[model samples]
Target: MNSPQLAIVLGTRPEIVKLAPIIRECRDRDVPHIVVHTGQHYSPQLTEVFFDELELPPPDHALGVGSATHGEQTGSMIAGIEEVLLEADPETVLVQGDTNTTLAATIAASKLDAELGHVEAGLRSDDRGMPEEVNRIICDHTADRLFAPTPAAAENLRAEGVPSDRISVTGNTVVDALQRHRGLAADRTAVLDDLGVEPGEYGLLTLHRAENVDDPDRFADLLTGVGRVAREYEMDVVYPAHPRARKKLEDLRVPNAVEVVEPLDYLEFLRLESDASVILTDSGGVQEEACVLGVPCVTLRENTERPETIAAGANRLGGVTPTGIFETAREMVGTDAEWENPFGDGDAAARILDAAAATDADGADDSAAATEAVQ
Candidate 1:
């Protein structure tokens, strides 16, 4: 009998990091699968270093659809992915998270005759203003299988009228990736030593969201708050600058007191994230990682999609203002990092792949059923 074929699509470092275990699961189970890179994360370190470090196979199809305006990026990815779907004709197409890549892949696969499974599904910020909010909403409604990280996420799906049978509160794949990689990072990485910092004595900052960095005044305010955190705490703060933020930071010529470094690879970054005293960021993925690693997190946004982190007592809302950011950092950074990880056990990839493979055992005819359900 032929092995079941699955098309796994992703485009960013976070997607690749979370999806590594799933891809590894597919390989171990003798399941035929392909990785489709959307190229939204275009840099070599952002894309290739992850696969290399994780020892996962390189993408079978790279759409080469790098960043552009939102409409242009999504439209290009949709076109590129549709061409792959038409040619590969896999039984299932799996996408994760709420990037443009995820949305476009959902649209492409939904239009094709393939079963769609969305990992890290059903999360909502409730504020439609965030672009990511828009993507995940459409994805949850369109997904045939919604793998939600928390019960809250599943409940949100249900509240939106998603059938309960289709929703599974599978823990977040972030946990899976972290568990599998954290030990390796600790053993192999000298990120702390290289950066000349002691573990649990410094703050780590990652700011790359458009709403924060693209605006000059807001960016200045964020840096001001971060500098304040460093001065007040008398602690070393490191910022691993994203490529998008680099130009903006330079253009603004904003001199932050924090140490700015090049972005580290998965293992190094994971090491840095785990050892930090606190993590301040505008990233959703980093918040989850910080919570799982028992690091205090001060979100630079007014609201978050992962309210579980806040409710679990791991995260604090540090709104965009300098005062909000400074106060929240001071409040959160020195507190006990005692929140239980609300994402999931380290076995989410196993469950996700099992669900994908079960579709194969059941038969290929379910594609039509899946299509009807998703549509």
Candidate 2:
């Protein structure tokens, strides 16, 4: 019998990070898999560095669809992915998380009548303001297999009318990547020495959402709040700055106290998260990473899809207001150890693969049934 072929699709940094473990699993199992990059975040600094650090293989196909209007980007990816699906003819197409890549690929594969599997399915922020919410809803609805990261996510799927049988509570794959790279983290204290700081002596910060950085006032509020906390706590703050965040910081004349360095690779970021006294961020994956590493998180957004972290006391929503930010940081810095990790252990990638294999088995049975019906 021939081994099944799988096409794993990813375009952005978070997608690459979350999908790497599963790609490794496919290689170890001798499964024929091809990786496709949509070029949603094509940057030598961001995408290339992560691929190098994670040792991800060069993508077999690159759509080269760089930044554009959301509609334009999604349309381009869908058309490109449809062509790849026709050419590759893989038995299944795998997508991770709620990005334009995920929604576009899901639409392309479903239109091609291929089985779709969604990792990190069923996340909801209940805020229609987020483009990601639309992507999440569309992908979950179309997926033949939904690999939810938590039971709460599974419940969200159930509430949204997804078939219960299609949803499986696999843990989050970010935890798998974190566990895999944490061994290297122990050897990475030089990042601290380079910054002239010690472990637990500072807060780690990251903010790069259009809503936050595009608004000059909101951006300044976040910067000022972080600087105030650093001063109040007598702590240093490191921001492995996103490109947009860095540009905004410069344009707004952000204060001197907040150190804005280039974004760190996965291992370095994980080490920073592990050692930081607290983490402040507007990124979803970082929120989950903080939870997995048992670091206190202050979300710099008005809402979040990962409310489980907040519920578990591992995180709080601080939005972009200076008062909100300072209060949340003070509370977190004072009570960092009080929170428990709401995300799961490191078995998420394995469980997700197991679910996909099971889905394949069931698909085979269904095909057999159709042939019998014809007979």
Candidate 3:
């Protein structure tokens, strides 16, 4: 088989969802590309199932580098991704978001004869204590092309002294995936009924960040705060527990008003986000989705990379304390969901691919130069 022109590297569920549109673009344009799953999220539910749901081709390579310490996990992913890069020898490698996989793939691709493009680049939470903050910083600095999702993100790249030529404000791909699939989710899934909640009457909750869920006290506090708000409003707060957070839930005291359920599939989750009155999450992707879906959002983090949501009045930062959560929920729950979608017009995939194809063309020219020099 001929070497692919592009290698799309992903590991977690969000990566699959965000990258699905780009992969589809490659297929539609008949661009030669291979997908490599680093298996940072090894669960079939989290990784493999998204391919089927998103109607994406199976990953050409699955590394199966499951959970471990940060060092151990990233180390395994770097080694595994290096092997894939060596074999495929793609002209460009694309990675998304700030996962261990993204950092690992960036490191591996930087060492090889490949141009690296980082989607959703130049986002800075400015909280280096967060593992994701560190991962994203490294990926942005090392990547050859930075696909900033907003002008603000592009400015961030500029502030970092990344040449403006290297950064493109391609918007966030989550908008593309949401716009494409939301109608399908509404029509195909009965997730609201299955969860025993009424549309526009329930609060959807998702907490998975290690800073939020790893500590039993913080985890319990977040749940308690969210649950109290749900009770105050006489609304049910549905928490779809991530695999990482489930273990913490087992040891904690869950509130009565918060119903903790197993993680839902992409369609189910999308449907939930659309129909819910408000969304409470620590996931950056969820913040973007809730904003686009016109559902008010209260981010559990003290700070967010997607400050666009806050500036647009579509979201609020609700810290981990119960009072803070309650106050923010009280402030946002009754507001009109009329905030304009700050992300884009649902065509980020095309812009990113356009930039990527240009990068691939430049790589060919550079390769040709090397060959001539050797001759």
The candidate that achieves the highest TM-score relative to the unseen native structure: 3
What lDDT is obtained when candidate 3 is compared to the true structure? 0.88
| Cα TM-score per model | 0.93, 0.92, 0.95
The reply for model 1, stretches above 4 Å from the true place, is: 1-4, 253-256, 359-375
lDDT of model 1, residue 73: 97
Error of 1 at 221 (Å): 0.6
lDDT computed for candidate 2: 0.83
Per-residue alpha-carbon lDDT of candidate 3 for residues 33-152, written as tens digits (9 for 90 to 100)? 999998888888887889999999789998888999999999999999999999999999999999999999999999999999999998988999988999999999999888888778
Instruction: Write candidate 2's Cα lDDT for 314-353 as tens digits.
Output: 8999878888999988878856566655556676777777
lDDT (tens digit, per residue) of candidate 1 on 231-296: 888888899998889888886644455998998898999999999988999999999999999999
What is the alpha-carbon lDDT for the whole of candidate 1?
Answer: 0.86
Quantify all predictions' global Cα lDDT against the true fold. 0.86, 0.83, 0.88
